[model samples]
Target chain A: MAEETKGFSKEEEEWIKAQRAREAERQKRLSRRGGDDKNAVNINSLMDIMVIMLVFLLKSYGDDPLKVVDEDLKVPRSTAQLEPVDATVVTVTRRAILVDDDEAVPIREGRVDPSQKGSGGQSSMRIIPLLDRLNDAVEQRRAEAQLLGEDFTPEATIIADQMTPHRLVLEVLYTATEAQLNQFRFAIIRSTTESVGGIAEATPEI
Target chain B: MARRSREEIGQPDDPDLAPFMNLVIILIPMLLLSVVFLEVAVINVTMPLGGSTTKDTDEPPDERLDLSIALAPNGFYITAAGYQRPPIEGCPTQGPTICLEDDSVDVAERFEEARRLLAAGQDADGESVMEEGLQAYNFRELYNMLSGFKEDFPDESTVRLAADPDIPFALTVRVMDVSRYRLTESSYDTNEAFWSAEFATETAEDGEEQFANLFGDPAFAVVQ
Candidate 1:
């Protein structure tokens, strides 16, 4: 064994043989103990952390009623305090208009496609495609409300990008109005700061 | 039977949690992906029931102030009870409308100055520039003007908000916001604490804080 240990001094070879012997002794001890000492990892602390993280994530997920997901759609910051409610969502991004996450109309250069407009093309306030989609949604919502024996209030939430042109917003509103959605809500990022300077206060006198 | 019992007693008490750990590993990433940290809220607005134009009624119009604000690309055109605001002498007019071009209340300039200070690593009046790209709308002046109107017509709550075709939707929302509330004080230390500090709020009978209203109800008008 000493001859087989090349490039190592006698003392170094002796150390290596001692290490091997210790390892073998430990292995023998493990085997005698029914091989149960295979580095049992303590994951109780890890499980506790994961459970806490899951609860937090779940809470945040359920808090928001509306999810504004488009990358091009940057919702404007405002001090409006009203909490968002579940309603028919009308999302107007820089590129397209979506009704309840379904693409209804295509927008280009901050203007609705002229062909999608009614009579006067880009000059027309009524967007034909958006009107059709909203009409369908209103009908469906009405039916659902009726089935549940509740009064149907035609409400829509408009999730528009901050850079969206007023023309596009008007067209969407007009289309929604035609579909009998009288109550319109503009979705905005809620902030308490006066940096934007629009603090909505309640007027009891009104 | 004796050997089996002995072997069972020697077994580890810890259950096999590998499957549960695997499940947690998968679930955490999926939930994290769908989680939204944004504080999203909504501003309620109503469309005129009879379209853009008001319907004719046999009864005479009440003393209620019919305030209409037209948001042009140049500036705001404010009209109340059929009286349009005439052009101010010193302020340079933007097109035909009476532009409120007060530099002291210019929101764009304040935003720019705040941004410059923040970029230079200096304090910006306790305000951090949260959003970029400010329009030239004089929101402070607008707020002051609306506050004055609220004083004159305390009972009036509705303001007709109409915007030119070229104006941005964000500007329209800003106009609605300024029209809705009256800021009692001018300055605040932090953005989060501003609402409680400056705004005129009173506690209701039920212990809820009641915000002082300016023009709380804003109706969208068609740009005809």
Candidate 2:
């Protein structure tokens, strides 16, 4: 064996030294860490909390009685307890009124134009364009319902701004009623502080 | 701060989860108790089929007292829609006194106070000073009168919440609450021990079912 080692090259001798250093380093690390990895943290309990948080967050999401499309419309606060059912949407912002993303009525500075047949300063109550579009949408929905063999109760969710005038709201209602979309849901911010028939100590959340 | 369950403080094989478990145990129940993490509710605001709907009346016109409330720039007006009775004004041009009651509660003053607080910033309960449409109207007096009106016409199912073209939709909704239900005082009625949850789950005549809608909430908004 001594003769074979003498026969070996200088590179082989250096490789053996490096291997010894690596083995020594490994032994040192194992001893320092008490024969286990110290970098790992016990995260099983944290995972439980994460799961719980996910479930809670999921439950709170998308449960609104009505889904609001326009982010501009700040719904009025209410203590109404009825949960929202899925339906066609009528979104009335401070500036414009839309039905299923279609601009059914034009509003300038929160008032319908006098030029519009059934909106603005005009007292006709029938938003002609709005009515027409809603009727078409309703008819299309009715057809879909018929195809699916579903009972179609023309359900419509009115998503209006809290600052929207009562006049505009009435106009929307009128237009909706004329279109035969009667089932209504007034979108509102959930007020956990107020209740029906209780002294509404809640300050108005605009 | 956890006591050793397995007597393995420095053991690298096991992860020390006592602290995390402790936090989660407290957090789960707290999230369960909160309303935001649970179900959200909505209100059903429906109108009659035709252009306008008259109240259900079997009595003569004189006996039928239809409650029609109009909110204008000057003040709040309560009138008999069925008949042509002159409106009873609350917060008229002269003062805050409504229906001969010596109410010192100044609607404008209260509104200013509320606005100041809001400008400075406030919590949900702190904003109670400015109820119903965010106008500086006397909600207490309004409540007192409505509650009395409820006594007068216990059978009245609908109330007309009419407003000027300028009145915002939010105020109308708040006014609806004032007309249809009674509000409770805030939990923190004092200097100490503020219980933020003071709202009562409304209970109807059925007792078990909540949402005791005081006015039956058959309200209508007149356009034009």
Candidate 3:
């Protein structure tokens, strides 16, 4: 019985032990390879989120004819339902007045600088710089229309801050009129309120 | 010989999404830069025709409403072609005509009281605040008066809106808003219409519901 239990010789026992060690090493290598595979980024879910966000952002971009991106400009809220038309934009920020994003005149203390006004100085309704820019814009539009064999419809859009004085607005409008841009549109944020027959509840009196 | 079993062939690799991921990542920031969150609309306005430009013609002159609304520092001065009435008590007149007064709220008196309180270094305490419920201009009253004019001259659509130099542009916009449309208690679900003849409901392009048109055409008039 003892001889049978110890039937394998030293060399045989050594071979068996070596075979077990080899199997363990092979298992370790397999596990290492599996861990490496796990490290590879599974970005499928991430791609899904990114694609959705991209679609949403693209839809919102460039949908409007005019974009009021200036931080200083706070357009008044109105119940007017008319959509904005494609026209020359005259922006009146707190610090300056811009025509087609070009600063035409500077404003000080919510009023146009006296030096920038035409003839009558501060009391004048005409703004020389703005009038010049508007005239050029009108002439360019006219030339473009003529080239396209279409009639020129002179129009402009006024995008003024809510706190802008009415005098400044009138001056801009008057300047545009002098430049032969008679049609005007005042840009405002569309208000969603039930008080349509009266002033909005959030409107400040003064 | 039998074809190789399915297990003998390795699974097909996933389509490379690296380029797509890069594209999406780049496009997101670019689009975000140009995205506009504010819903902007426009109020159409025109410069009032100057009196000096009246042309000589053989055609009989049409009777005009000549509706003008002047937003002065004190109050609104309204003038029309045929409408005339005595001015409110203690209200001032424009030349020979009795202009309308802002009778709804005494904004000037409220400001005076506020100034006094501030000078005395006192808090409002239980007293109503100066700006609360006290509008500088009586916009509701103005709307009512304009509605009356619309009733009288349904054909007249033009109104000359003038404003004081110091008036905020927001106030002018508010006036324009009130002048443009008259809101009724009508909804899409309601089959019945209140004052349907005057307050017709129309859906805007963006699916927003709107009320009937009032003096839809407003012209900017130079302050006299």
Candidate 4:
């Protein structure tokens, strides 16, 4: 057999050159069109999607706090959606009485102070202690209102434990009523549809 | 020419909305749910009933208005004192067939008897005994006894709650809600901490439909 030619014949060479040119042209066309879409980031669309997701996630959550009565009777949950509009709040806890941030008077369970002692072995409710604190706060608020020329009185809201003795609660109410804080509102947890008798009724006369 | 035609068609270069749509569908529901959740109110309000010691002498002594709901460690005893007459000899001791224990008569029966007596008194006048029918009891009995008052004293405005020391706070609240009032007292001294809650008025127009609104519609706290 004759030795194989190292180079192509004229016809073969022409075909090879034409094929190379065609491939180069195709490659050039592809490059001009733009490279593969690998790293392009659609930031505007991404931001839009992120914002939508953020808003949707926010909507799914309930801002209302889970009202649970803990062992420590602190921060009672209220169903009255109305904000505590009353500037003055008198919070009576098992521990003590709190009025704004002035101070707290520790109330002992089952036993009251000597000042509340009645003639009978029954001790009077220790409301005097609470009233004194409240009165002082009211007086301060009144003076402030006078200085600022604002309208203010002892219009206060009372927050007390549902279990607090009626006697004690009465004392607080009597004291408040005496202070001319007739307009009052109570904070309660709205749960099941069960009746909470007698104590919650607000009879202006009583 | 083909590329130019394709460009004129305005087809988006990329086609992927999986993440975008997924985010929108999930996010929209969550935000709506959260806002609805925020609006709900959770309140546990205990209302009060009408009964007073001081006003006993002022009102006509027709029916036994003093309802004592004695709560013992084991069970409870509801004693009605101000009725025109005692319950028709409860349980009929040694009458026809057998005898029953004094406490064996169901409190429900007692309440029925009390209702019958009030109804009979109203029939006597042939108008309405709205003014006469009144019950003053403690929590457990008060809750059970309220319907009777509602039926007989439908037009009567208030009932009193005279609770004993043994009543639990939860039970007391239940009774107050049934009576539809929060017992509060008037203070002689504004500085005084303690006061008494009493039945101050009675009227025909004031009517309470729902137990929730038993206290005032505003739901004020009462102290005695």
In the order shown, the candidates' DockQ scores are 0.37, 0.26, 0.44, 0.11
Q: Could you give the interface RMSD of candidate 4 in angstroms? A: 12.1
Instruction: Report the C-alpha lDDT of model 1 over B1-224, residue by residue, as the tens digit.
Output: 11333323576545778898898889899998887566788898877744343334353444445788888645677876568765545456544244544344544444445434533545333133323223345555556567777877787788887776656676788787777766665333433344344567867679998887778788877654
Indicate the worst ten consecutive residues by lDDT in candidate 3 chain B: B186-195
Ranking by TM-score: 1, 3, 2, 4
Model 2 segments more than 4 A misplaced: A1-60, A65-71, A101-103, A118-121, A147-150, A192-206, B1-40, B49-51, B55-57, B81-133, B182-211, B221-224
Candidate 3 has which clashing residue pairs, if any? none
Q: What does the i-RMS of model 1 come to?
A: 4.4
The top-ranked prediction according to lDDT is 1
How many backbone overlaps does candidate 3 show?
A: 0
Candidate 4 structure quality by residue, lDDT tens digits, B1-224: 11232323676545676687676667676565444322222232223322232233555554434433332222334333453222223323333111122243343333334334333443223111211111122233333344354344443433333343422233333333435532232212221111123233444346733222223222223334
State the lDDT of candidate 3 residue by residue for A16-128, as single tens digits: 66656766775687577574446666788898899889877766665666755455666767777789988888999877899988888888767888888888887888899
**What is candidate 4's CA lDDT for residue A61?**
55
Q: Which regions of candidate 4 fall more than 4 Å away from where they truly are?
A: A1-71, A74-87, A101-103, A110-112, A115-122, A140-155, A194-206, B1-141, B165-168, B181-224
Q: What docking grade does candidate 3 earn?
A: acceptable
lDDT of 1 by residue, A1-206 (tens): 75678988888787677667866886887678666465645678999999899888888877767866445666777778998888999999867899999999888777887898999977888899999999999999999999999999889999997667677787888889889998989998776544464344231110
In candidate 4, what are the lDDT values of residues A1-206, reduced to their tens digit? Answer: 11333355777666556656766775676577675334444466766866766765664453333322323232222223344354466666655556764434565652345554333334443355566777787898899999999888557666665444445555555556555565555554442221112224231110
Which wins on TM-score, candidate 1 or candidate 2? 1
TM-score of each: 0.74, 0.61, 0.69, 0.43
